[model samples]
Target chain A: MARVLTIGEPMGLMVATEPKALKDVTTFRRYVCGAEVNFAVGMSRLGHETAYISRVGNDPFGQHILDFLAEQHISTDYVTLDDVNRTGMQLKAKTLEGDPEVVNFRRFTAFSYMEPSVVDTVQWESYDHLHVTGIPPALSETCRETSIAMMKAAKAHGVQVSFDTNLRPALWPSEDVMRKNINYLASLADIVLPGLGEGKILTGFETPEEIADFYLKQGAKAVIVKLGTKGAYVKTTDETFYAPAYIVENVVDTVGAGDGFAVGTISGRLEGLSWSEAVRRGAAIGALQVQVESDNEGLPTLEQLVAYQNSAKLSE
Target chain B: MARVLTIGEPMGLMVATEPKALKDVTTFRRYVCGAEVNFAVGMSRLGHETAYISRVGNDPFGQHILDFLAEQHISTDYVTLDDVNRTGMQLKAKTLEGDPEVVNFRRFTAFSYMEPSVVDTVQWESYDHLHVTGIPPALSETCRETSIAMMKAAKAHGVQVSFDTNLRPALWPSEDVMRKNINYLASLADIVLPGLGEGKILTGFETPEEIADFYLKQGAKAVIVKLGTKGAYVKTTDETFYAPAYIVENVVDTVGAGDGFAVGTISGRLEGLSWSEAVRRGAAIGALQVQVESDNEGLPTLEQLVAYQNSAKLSE
Candidate 1:
């Protein structure tokens, strides 16, 4: 039995080799990156037994993703193969200043058309935690049903659930439907992690406290509000805390910082850490993630995490 | 029967949507862009009767490429479908200041594995001009042999040949091998087009005149030296001419500018334009290409070219 299970579509990632604009670039590098896969990789690096369950195309890119997971020592037995469509992908270009430009290439991607019957083979009772995001549902109706089915099965088996509102506006038809469906999913999760901006848009809340409160009122056991570089705010039935951000000298890439934060929080909680301690670990890991490129390449192992924490205290 | 025939691998192109660093990009857009296809598209737009000969994977991308060629009204009857390897692709990143970054995904590509047997199906006697690049030879041994075989067949059938020294450093084992192979290819061409930098490195020549002289001595009837934004210098058996640069207002993308120049020069020659007129058209097209984003999107139509030339003369 794994400590954590994450299910979503993993896409082939294409990036500019240098910090040149898209029009001027003559070369690029390739990798596998997705929000769910990032979390799975991060959790596995942090000494958790993580299982990634999803469908990938039977293409070279799909093989590349499987090979990558094998190298990371993450379990993929639950992943199915799709023959009809090719794996999804994304292209990224970055400049010297400001946020990176992103474009989605997942329309009619293989995973979007994954049959619901494939999820029946997944062992529901073998995981302590189930982590999901809003992307799979918005991909296709079949994927939406699969997501809902997985959530229901996990709940029935008494597994803890974590849902991140990783909303992609381009994937959805309208804001109203997105909010309705995502909010419904939030009610099924034990813990809800949503960025301040995402929560504000989904729930029409202006402040972090209001955003957290909205989710908490929607049957969540706890709500963690991500505030970008300012760290996160946590609100539970009996307690609350504001975890301060760790300052890093340079911010190289910001793609998978949130997933890193999720890994830290999930791993810390599973290890029986205090709520504040878990949030602190999350902040530390998230800060470290921004200094490196790639989604999971910057993830720290459990030993490295402890060393970073100890070194910071010693220097203070 | 077409005036121009181009032989090379046409790869699918995946690009990042916005100006985001590789590590921070979360999405991408997909298109089909390659050196040969770029040249074919440009020439077709310039009113040249062009035929493209190559192999593509029997995949959606291949189908898409066929559809795109039809949309552009370029002939694709000579394109073969491969059952084994998939179509090659390149990932491009959006640029901010200079040239956009490019990453090649062409290993074991279907076009690289093109069998020499496929060339038997191509009608070599019908074409007036055949344009070849160094990339086909660098792909694989099979592709290299096919390139050699095609050149021999074209020459045996009395087809004029134009070769471009589009050097890809990473594709070759060493600089020595690249130079040796490229120079041998130059010997087979009636007219050779080499960038100033490429000519310097390949022939160890300091001046464009020296580089042109070297190729001319190597059996080339003429040589045109590309000087980037400075325009081009042409040396033929009859005369020598230097085309002045056309000043662009703002440079958007520069990926396919060289190919655009090739298209203009080839179309001009086929139309019986004088050496100076051909080089001038090349410079005008190259200048126009840098102001557009996609590699082949900004190629000027025959009407556009005439209007541009007429307007420029009026302004002067």
Candidate 2:
């Protein structure tokens, strides 16, 4: 099995227990989640060796997240506790219509204080794949430097790099800065993934083909464009095609669909699948992810994925 | 020492950790507080036997509040756990410019479901005073009926009734309902306490004496109007006077000043202090309460109160 290492922030989520405005909600169920952590968890469940690195506060919420990661079998060798800054938290108001409304309380958190010294001592040679996201670099200037240090170390070790353009505009100083920094990171990744909406903003491209071409021209080996339920557009130096979606009968939540897709794509590649076949796996995982309430609950195991694929072929 | 029984909702409070807007804050320090509970806690600290009656959700926050009250030596004999509905919570954003912005998440909570049946079993005769507030009656139709039932039982037992017009306009269905219900409750109480602002809205009286006369005509034995740092105005059938405030150089928080005043007034009356002397005690507590950062942290014990009064005399 291939080993993948991801670095980002994990926040304590307080999800509303009922369908109401946040101001009217009195109860919440707590959970630990983040885009990169969700990706790592999805990979680990598929029998891949996954590791996560981040800083958490010396608080109960921090302890909870660490315990959750350990239970999920994600290695926490580089994880550390921060005494001065507390962990970040989010309040999500559950709704009957559309997506839930979320209020993020992540400013001045332990994750934002990540410094270059964190990655300087890491043994990058042990990890086969370095997975990163756009969020970490946007947290703070020091975190930006740390992200570059980690990516440069992975590159020096000749490891494959995968980057997800999970853009959060509120975390950045400006759209211009985010675009410049995200494009720089995407250029460094062998496989670059961006949602259709994020592509349009970052590359000024209106279509999936154009967006993929923009990233490919920047020296990326392949670019995959996420198109929600319509599926994904995959492009390499020599080929390009669209992967159709697996139609889900019930969509309970759509929070971590992209992370599931990333997990499938990365793991499928490590298992020696062709680029087009990997994109198909990504599409299937994304479809499965939206069928469950909790963010990453519907992410499939190896047996579950094979069973699901076989059933879909039979129905077809 | 006299016995005081208070019945109302207790809430889990999430106070922001720094000076910031509600949307910007990411950390909160949790506390348990309520209007009647605050009054009861204040009385309990003064060596009075205080009992609280309410319904709390069978949840961690509810349990925490119960444990906190027990630690403070307030009897929770009549408190029951609600199986279905959860306890209420409020988020307070810390600020340096003014009173913190608060958002209530108390709708459809256990306290709102308190019925007349809760009051039916209470031994109202054993209590020397029944402390109630305008807030509980405004929660739900059942709570309104419960408040009336409690006041009627206290009247039947010849127990002194202390009612605070702790106005929360948003909790009521309409202003008319709140005004009518509050006025009716005030007429039934031996002591009616209203802040100057609440009195203006409830009675449309321009001055404290006029406000006191309005309550006195409605069969109230005494009326006390809180006039902030200017002190309190007290009026009985035969006498009326203004108790000037003790000048405090620093005012950290003013959220629970009125609750402190009620505590001092109720306890002072129990201690056989004259009406004017009780009003002075009310003013002293109000002055002291605003000198601390926490909501009710500045509320003092009897010895502390005596020491404070002596110091104020020396300073003057």
Candidate 3:
């Protein structure tokens, strides 16, 4: 099995069970959430040897996250327990359709204390792929330096890098700083994933082709532009194509669709599938995520993925 | 020493160390805080046998607060450890003058699950006084019932009751409801402590004597009105007078000054001090609370209080 590695902050998520504004929501159902959390769980479900790295506080939320990761079969050997800082928490308001309203209390959390020392312990040579997002750089100066260090180490060890340009303007000090740092990291990855909106801001481009061309010129092997309901567009030195989006009649929550897409694409490529086939799987998984509620719960196993693909073929 | 009992939700307080708004602040110092927390700690410091009743979660914040209560020598025999619901939390911004900005996340907490059964378990006959606030009734229906039940039990066992109209308008559904419930609770107490603004809204009276007469007619033996810098105005069935405020040159925070005032007044009476002398102690403690950053850190021990009184006498 291909070993995949990803890192980011995992926060305690308090999901409102009832449909109400956050101020009016009295009771909530707690869950574990993060961008990298979804990607790791998705990779694990597809039979990949996925390992996650991060720091958690000596709090109940931290303990709960560790137990959850263990249950999902993701290795937590690299996770460190911090005694001083606290685990981050977020409260989400429930909605019937579209994205839920979320307020994150993640500033100065335990994860923000992550430094370059943790990256020094990682066995980069043993991993086939490394997954990362723009979030770590936005956390703290140390986290930014460490994220860049990890990516550089991956390249030196012949490990394939996949970077997701997940823009969080609120977490960044300024737009100029966020764009500069995010683009630099994306240029270091073999495959870069950016939503249409993120692409426009990061590259100052009007179209998906222009956005893809901007990253491809920076030495990226391939750049994928997510086009919402229109699916995704990809551009490489050799070829370019579009992966049509699957029709999801009822879109429940669209929070983790990007991470799911990353999971399907990365897992498909690791299975020795063609680039077009990998992009198709990414589209299928993105469709699956919007139909369910929680972040990684909708991720399909290898058997389930094959079943879903076969059924889609029959319908077509 | 007199046995003093009090009940309410104790929360994990994260106080911003820097003079920035909560959104701009990164690091915060954690502390155990609540209305009753301050009162209990104050009473314990004065060598009173103080006991606190409430429910806390199985989370880290809950455990931390329990440890803190134990450190202050407040009896936790009646505090229940809830496994399901979580302990509430609040984040306060640092300010140089007046009250600090506070954001509370206390809805549907572990303490909200408190029922009348908890009141039934209390050894009412052994306690000399029961302290309560308007906050408990605003928590939930079960908590309101429990609070009312505790007060009824205190009266039946000849235990004196002191009600603090610490108005929390945001926690209530409406102002009318708050007035109705708080006034009902105040009428049942031997002494009622209401801030000037609270007295205005609750009784629609412009003068302290008029507000005092309102509660006095409703069966309250004494009514104490907190008049901010003007100190306090007290009207018992027998006497009426004003306790002038102490000169506090530098005011840091005024969040828990009322609780400190309540602690001084209650503890003084338990020591068999005259009403005027007790109110003077209340004014002194309130002055001290404004000089410190944390809620209960400024609350003086018996020794410190005596020393402060002696020093103030020398200065005067």
What's the TM-score of every candidate structure? 0.57, 0.57, 0.57
- Tens-place lDDT per residue, model 2, A187-263, is 88889999999999999989999999999989899999998878889999878888877777766767888999999
lDDT of every predicted structure (CA atoms) = 0.81, 0.83, 0.86
Clashes of each: 33, 0, 0
Write candidate 3's Cα lDDT for B143-182 as tens digits. 8898899999899999999999998997788999999999
True A-B contacts kept by model 1: 0.00
lDDT of 3 by residue, A1-316 (tens): 7999999999877676678765445345567889999999999999999999999876656777888899999999999998767777876668899999886767677899899888789988779999999998999999998899889999999999999999999888789999999999998999999999999999999999999999999989988899877889989788898878777888888988999999988888899988889888987888788877677778888888878776653112
Q: For each prediction, how big is the interface RMSD? A: 9.8, 13.4, 15.2
Q: Give the least accurate 10-residue stretch of model 3 chain B, judged by summed lDDT.
A: B307-316
Give the CAPRI rating of model 2: incorrect
Q: After superposition, how far is residue A217 of candidate 3 from its true place, in Å?
A: 38
* Top-scoring candidate (lDDT): 3
Chain B TM-score against the true chain B, each candidate: 0.95, 0.96, 0.98
lDDT of 2 by residue, B1-316 (tens): 9999999999877766677654345456667768888898889989999999999986655777788889889999999998767777666666663466776656677888898998877888679999999999988999999999999899999899999999999777778888888999898898999999999889988999899999999999999998887788899887888878788776666777899999999999999999878878877887787776556678898899988887873122
Chain A TM-score vs. truth, each candidate? 0.95, 0.96, 0.97
lDDT for A289 (candidate 1): 75
